[model samples]
Target: MSSAREPKAPTRPTSRDYRLTMYRTRHDAAVRRLAASLRGMPADIPVRLAKPGSNLFRFGGRDRRPGLPVDGLDTVLSIDVDARTAEVGGLITYERLVAATLPHELMPTVVPQLKTITLGGAVAGLGIESTSFRAGMPHEAVREMDVLTGSGDVVTVCPGDDLFECFPNSYGTLGYAVRLVIELAPTMPTVALRHVRYVTGRELFDGLAEHVDDPEVDFCDGVSFTPCESYVTLGRFTIEPGPTSDYTGQSIYYRSIRRRDTDRLTVADYLWRWDTDWFWCSAAFGVQNRHLRRFWPVPLRRSDVYRRLVALDRRIGLSRRIARARGQRREAVIQDVEIPLAESASFLDAFSRHIPIRPVWICPLRSTTATTPPLYPLTSGTYVNFGFWATVGLADGQADDHHNRLVEQLVIDHGGHKSLYSTVHYDRSQFWRDYDESAYRQVKKRYDPTGRLPDLFDKVVGDNATR
Candidate 1:
């Protein structure tokens, strides 16, 4: 050109760039508000989170203390498609996170079975899924996290940090995760399933061990209807277009395992298959009944909805009254325990003989790294997670915690550990022995020296804690 043209104006940000910037700004403001709230809290009272819902089965009187306001903390801030990473707010549920990531053809390394489970809650507590045998637990996928410590400081902790190492299974005693950078894995458009039936527990566990290290299998878990009737379901990702089954409607997922030897589902449906019927626990509320299933709204068919109904029953003692009227004494025996693969059969045999609950869920897991997280210790090897949720009739002479206590001792005897998400019956010494007390104290001291949060033992064990 004959004349020098004026420099072009700076390029404007793209729509995605603008949205990401806005999300980050809102996240930062929310963090500041939470930190200020924590700092303003009186030293005498223990702290709690003002979350809308909880997946925890520990039911009791609600804490009267005002909780920290955590508004705007349940958002997905950014996603790096090329890097296969996502930075999400702590309170973001896996359901929402999946929605955000699926369009990019990616998903978290290990998506827990339930959709309502929060990213932060899964990290702070523990979460496992079918992919756990290869990818490990949810916390193992976190690249870094911003935790709001009890001292009112927001610290970005990575893998090597002591706080980060002990954060899982701490159950928020040290601090609460506000933002997390997590690794993601590519996903196919659909998943194909194969249900292999086994006649015995030994056969079931042996069949499971074979698939744990197989590169071809993308997902692995088993269901034991009884000692003699069990099925090891294996899932594989596929790109081939095919007609998929619909379990969200009247057809139940667990029942399908028993009926169908082969099935196919879209990636999203496969990840949340168990959530539709709450893994057969919906039977307690008559949702499994064909008559009632017709009337149950599809949108409300969620794990959280069933959990709320359970909470309401607990509040009014509806189940207790029903049992009393029937001249029966039943104890809720909801629990998940992990046993070394070699001893899984023995543990399951003992469980079948003692605990009457059936349709036990068995998921295999292995640590992604050689070094296990300190709080929830798992040596570098394969372990089987057994989950059973139902009420067992208590003998006239037995205590309410009889079955739970037996499960705890059985887990210890089998060289295993039990998850603390449900009712805990351990004394202080026993609980400390099962979990590394020394390691916990050191990390707790470092992150929360003033002890703004409740102690792990007191928080989890509740009234059962032996002072």
Candidate 2:
């Protein structure tokens, strides 16, 4: 050891320090405080680390309006670069994580298109992205997590642990993920992207399969405007920049039927490429006004544009009134169902005939379950997520329910699973038929013995008569 008389060296900037300094504050103690608050509370009480406006809380049949909201947990805890991991609070957004990791030349393996997605939401809600075909779901990339149980116990969980598997798609009904150590991978400064057009679902699947299976391809997704017209986009991290292709500057959104050539984009641009137009679906909001789009583009680039739109809808209250006036609970249809690759053609055919949604996003995702692991929502298979979202004219509220059940039937009939982020019409039998509730219940009992959190079945299979 050096002598005291000797000048001491300055403390070097570590990855942890660099990352922690990026955030405004650290609320590590808030984890246990939130857990303790839930100790004798009513089971119906809802707990969240973030505000309700940040998420689709009222989606599906359940209206999870917060009773006891837990705020101030949105902060980046730490980032350990040497271990290739980033420890983030559950409420921390992907946008913050991106900022913390980019300085270190690292990125989360799988990030949803929306940067507003929280680490806990992504893990608990089963988030996947274009890169999910290779890296698997965001939950699969979790290295470790600090979970607060209903019994006021804070437990550290890791992969292969019993409670770890139940956390995915549980919707925080089992327990709250206070902190998470997410695995990170090295990323290039830029990403090279190419789009290939396909006339049929089979051709689109074939193209997607080819790219997903290719080791060189880093990201892959497909957008179908019609049953006969689709485009498959494959992206790869690249050091050398090729021809410039900027989607933000175009007259029409990139997801439109217009053909495009290979181009290069910054990694951030590649990740949030759809934000400018919300996958060409923002035409519903009049962002499609070509003249206005040219003059004003900055406001459209906001990451929370979708959330803002919902807030505007709620603020105006006219949309809800319109639905009420029409005796309808829904005026739009937005659902994502992940089905086996083989069933894609059939499902798309049915989807085209039923909903006929345009700009259908199809992202290939590989299941991460073991060869014989207890069955989860996503069974072992090569699956493709079909994001079918569009306005559906409903004669009454019951019609929306009919559409919900019809879609659920189509998914089940085709051997697929639904994304719980949207409305789920599954009853107890139907829900258990798709998920291994037995295993989930066991894990729930072990961690949340007091039943402080909401019941899993109650939260997932809401008692709404619509179902």
The TM-score leader among the candidates is 1
Q: Which candidate wins on lDDT? A: 1
Cα displacement (Å) at residue 320, model 1: 0.5
Candidate 2 lDDT by residue in tens digits, 1-467: 11012111311335445555544233544654576666646666655443454545244333444443356566766667788898778877888888888888899998787778888888887787888898888888888777777667677777777777678877777777777889998898898877788888888887777788899888888788778888888788988855545666644446443456566788887887776676666676666676666665665555477557865775677777987797656545668888999899899989888764676888899965462223345664789998876666565335545777788999988999887776566888888878777887787787777676666567655534211
lDDT of each: 0.89, 0.71
Q: What's the distance in Å from true for residue 23, model 2? A: 7.1
Once fitted onto the true fold, the runs of candidate 1 whose alpha carbons sit more than 4 angstroms away are 1-16, 464-467
Query: What range of 10 consecutive residues in model 1 has the weakest lDDT sum?
Result: 1-10
Q: Which stretches of candidate 2 lie over 4 Å from their true place?
A: 1-25, 40-52, 57-72, 248-253, 294-300, 311-317, 320-330, 369-375, 395-398, 462-467
Q: What TM-score should be assigned to candidate 1? A: 0.96
Q: How far is candidate 1 from the true structure (C-alpha RMSD, Å)?
A: 7.0
Could you tell me the lDDT of residue 393 within candidate 2? 58
Tens-digit per-residue lDDT, 1-467, candidate 1? 01112322322434467777777778878988999999998899877888888888888775577789888888998889999999899999999999999999999999998889999999998999999999999999998888988878888788877888888998989899999999999999999999999998888888898989789999999899878999989999999999999999989999999999999999999999999999999998899999999999999899999999999998899989989999999999999998999999999999999999998999999989756777789872899999999999988899888999999999989989988888898888989888889988988887789889889999899553311
Candidate 2 has what TM-score?
Answer: 0.86
